[model samples]
Target: MKLDLTIPSLGPCHVDSPLKLSKQKGISTFNYSDDTQKILYDTSLKNFEACLAKGEAPLAFEKAGPREKIYFDPSKTKAAIVTCGGLCPGINNVIRGLVMGLYYRYGVNNTIGIKYGYEGFIPSFGHPFVELTPRNVADIHKSGGTILGSSRGKQNVSEVVDTLDRHNINILFAIGGDGTLRGVQAIVEEIERRGLKIAVAGIPKTIDNDINFIEKSFGFETAFTTANPIIRDAHNEAKGAYNGIAIVKLMGRDSGFIAVNAALSMPDVNFVIIPEMDFELEGENGLLAAIQRRLAKTKHALVVVAEGAGQFLFNNELGTDASGNIKYHDIGIFLKDKIVEHFKKQNMPATVKYIDPSYIIRSAPANASDSVFCGKLALNAVHGAMAGKTGFVVGRWNNQFIHLPIPVAVKERMKIDLQGELWWNVLEATGQPMEMKS
Candidate 1:
């Protein structure tokens, strides 16, 4: 894994040991640090050639905001905060953190909380605005749901723009998941269309950890840790009865981070199902067959399934929610029914138990790790917004707060890398087969 920078026809282009090279033709090349260059030099020739053909360096995340003046003057700045989408563990912590950051760090006391997401900003809805202060947000971090409340459904763009203008908000911080970020993107576009200089920043808030490129999303740790006891209960329940199978379904609409991580957290899980991988209910290595095999080895078995798993077996006429995300068929119930039916067909006595703890897991308060992460996300979002960095979501990348553009954040949903270490570790821990037939 080495690279020789000598050009074929031009002989050796003389340069310093450390040099900045830009592509001669295109403007798509990326700036590489000295360390990045060294890494590139140590890479394989095939990969190095591929990197050159792409006309960009190996991915690099730059800091957000411009090199010019800041966007807001503390004395004259007014900020707005809103929460959207489903409940997660750290929503309240984020609200309290943002309020404290604005009030104490920047001395901006004119922060307004928009209730019920974008709907609250519409004039028809009374344009509900709650003036926030340190005193009011003191104990909010100890709560679970957002103090500002939340809702789904997209609001009128023009009306939202009008409301922001009427409120004279200098910056806005949106706390939610991908759908919420898209909504924020619309608001920012409208503000730009109106020639307003208001800055918008998003705080990634998906408990599923499905937002692409974000190393970690707030509340995932809290949700995963909180779900451990539930999984243990399922495991214990399986052991209580003879020939018992317990299937516990966790949350993960599009991705299976929660299901996979919960399997990792609770090692007693005999089988784990996720949306990323496919498995069948019958046939040689299918799920039902696999459960029978496990039961042959042990009297009881515990299974963990993501809510979004085994969706291909369901009806084609699937539904969607307000965010336009496809509604997932219940994998837990489907697994339970199939297991029971298989046992009955074999003339074997068995008890199948299904537990869905989605609501209970998502509604819990933030744990220590998530509370700290939520605070960092909030502080960074506010700092980025105040610095005129708009149209970006503040997320932790490489263990640092980075301003990821909204478009990039929502471009693709992050799923478990089936071939990656995390999945491999899950396999090692659960002793599950890599593939279950087709």
Candidate 2:
């Protein structure tokens, strides 16, 4: 599928950037990013060859960084930041990064933090806005969760824009996942309809790392890292008793990155289940049969299942949540009961342990790697906004940060390619069958 990588802008940038860097061509010095700099959407040689053979320009995204020229004047620019959706490891790191980048890097001192997601924008919510500064946000990176707080739900677009206008906010840095980014798009449309020059920038903030086009979203590495030890502990738990089985339920709602990665990292995981693949609980080739076989061989087993996995087993509809996402049934608990019943029916003794570390992993502070990534994402977002870029989200693609339009970024979620090498590696690591269907 062809993607439109064009980024929308308020107008031409004219103000000079406050950051000083050498721009000499022959000298070895740091240079500002040119508007013409772009990163290819598809870097594969096969795709490049086919595009060249067809005489079509390959799709590309605008490289994200600081531009020599900016549109908003530092002294007059009033910036606002709001974090929405669920909590992740590095929300505070991102918030602090934005505040520091705006205050010190660009001399943009007028910054405010929205209290509770989009609800802060609605006056009736009665949420107070906090003034952001380098001093106040100095140690926020040391903590987990967003200091500004977060929520899941849609707010009125017109009312949100009205709040921005009332506060004379020129730049808005919205940090959230799919739902929050969609909200940002609506606010952008409202601003455009009213001919406002407010620049909206999104920082993808999902622990699932399901945002489209981004190679890795912030807080993902931290999540899997935090989950690594839990999987190992589960492995030990399984190995401790006779016919022991340990099930670890991780935080991948739509994608299985966390489950697969954590299982791969721990090696002792016998089965890795995700939303992308389907499996049955009964029959010869079903998960239960496989577990029985595993216990017969090793006398112990470990399973890692994503929260969104095995959702087809549920009969009653749980409906959607406040963010319009389907409320998934507890697959981990379901699998535990099914396994216990199946073993009992077979007249076999089994010890079962279920661990759900979703909240613990999500609320922990970001590790060293994710902390650095969050800071970079935040700074790049500020750079784009100051350069007049709007309706765009900052993401890293092919190891480089780039500007992605909100519409395109939220078009679809990034899922594990079951046919690709990652899944192959996962299968190799876990020694799980490619198909667990009857």
Candidate 3:
């Protein structure tokens, strides 16, 4: 095939010195260095053609139904509760509620407690069980530590499943924080792999109050309730004793929940410092300046700070145990020491009083709201399982006890609904600052 070629873009007569035109044989081919057409795309049938094709008897089944049905056995009703991580105050209340709900209300008699958390549930460690009954948990609502006790951290998923199978407990309730919930996920996945059926539910119970899905965990209410009176009484004492400032630090890692609550309880509080807020700690002169300013106007002022507030204290926080766990020391003590040190340095005339409320907050008796929340959360977990619902953490949303799915909660990060602006407004009205310094 003989063909004539034209370089249309460039002028025919004008050529660069380095350019050359070569002539070929009669069977002329535009012999480029490389030639390959890799793709020849195609389109699917149109409406008419597709309609003409057979619509019925298209055969393929990707999967079949399960060989064995996993229906709940009414006669085989059993439950196991495990508490992992540090002991939160309302562990007993949740356990008590679960037992009571399962036995008296639902007639589930064979409830056993998984002793010492998921760590003890491992086959490597001998499986320890607690025989649960209404009588056993009679006064547990007022109790502190888990009656079954608890261990910290997690175990392998297979190990958890093996332990679950060993105990033959159909329903497992995990009581702790985020770590405990993650462990539950692992165990659930493994149980699915084994084709075994078990209902896994997580009850939020962290002093940190960082877990998602649950807006408020069981013990946090108790903690605040326990701290409320001390805050009131402490503020009163500090006010009566001196015309100076008294700082009370509560436990909260970064969230202002605890400090915010304490500050609300003592509205005359001078300043509230939580990790979520600003992280600046000042000397006595600044605090004293504010206190004296308030005292000049009013009497004495109280301040609430979070436990995780680092370096805001005069005394170094106490170290943890041999296991390398950090024990939260008194935030109040830190404030008190700083105030005392500031007074010594400035030689101020006002009597400075420093009091740590860490011990008092932990020892706080269970409050009405907290006890109710804890009990409700336990019942929610059980019923949620009986209904075969999962990934939801029990909480009070819109003044009703409900399940907040973990997927939805994680995407939202268990945060305060700033968009609503109502909670924030109420907080500000209660004398809780969104941010506080020193």
TM-score of each: 0.87, 0.99, 0.71
- Give me the overall lDDT of model 2: 0.94
The list of candidate 2 runs beyond 4 A from truth reads 26-28
- Cα lDDT tens digits, model 2, 1-438, are 678888999999999999986777656676799779999988999999999999998888899999999999999999999999999999999999999999999999999999989999999999999999999999999999989999889998999999999989999999999999999999999999999999999999999999999999999999999999999999999999999999999999999999988887778899999999988888889999999999999999999999999899989989899999999999999999998999999999999999999999999999999999999999999999999999999999989999999999899999999999999999898888899987
Which of the two candidates, 2 or 3, achieves a greater lDDT against the reference?
2
lDDT of 1 by residue, 1-438 (tens): 222221011112122211224424355754322211111222456766777898756544444321223446677889989999999999989999998988886678899899988888887877568988999989988988888889988888889889888878888889999999999889888888888877888898999999977889989999999889999999999999999889899999779999888888999998989999987888988888888888888989999988888898886756789888887777788878888888999999998888999999998999998999888788767666666667888776656556677877888899988999999998899888899876
Give the C-alpha miss distance for residue 19 in model 1, angstroms.
35
lDDT tens readout by residue for model 3, 1-438 = 111111011012111211122334255732111011111111233533543484522211111111111234435667888888767777888898888877764467888888878767775677567788999889977766767877765567787788778778778888867666666666767777786667777777777566653456667766766667767776786678556566666777646576666566556565666554334346333444555556666566677767765544436656764224456655566666665775577665555555566655654545777787777777766655544444445565434454544433334234334434634643574444443344
Which prediction has the highest lDDT against the true structure?
A: 2
lDDT of 1 at 259: 88
Q: Rank the candidates by TM-score, best first.
A: 2, 1, 3
After the best TM-score superposition of candidate 3, give how far the Cα of residue 39 lies from its true spot, in angstroms. Answer: 52
TM-score of 3: 0.71
Against the true structure, candidate 1 has what lDDT?
0.80
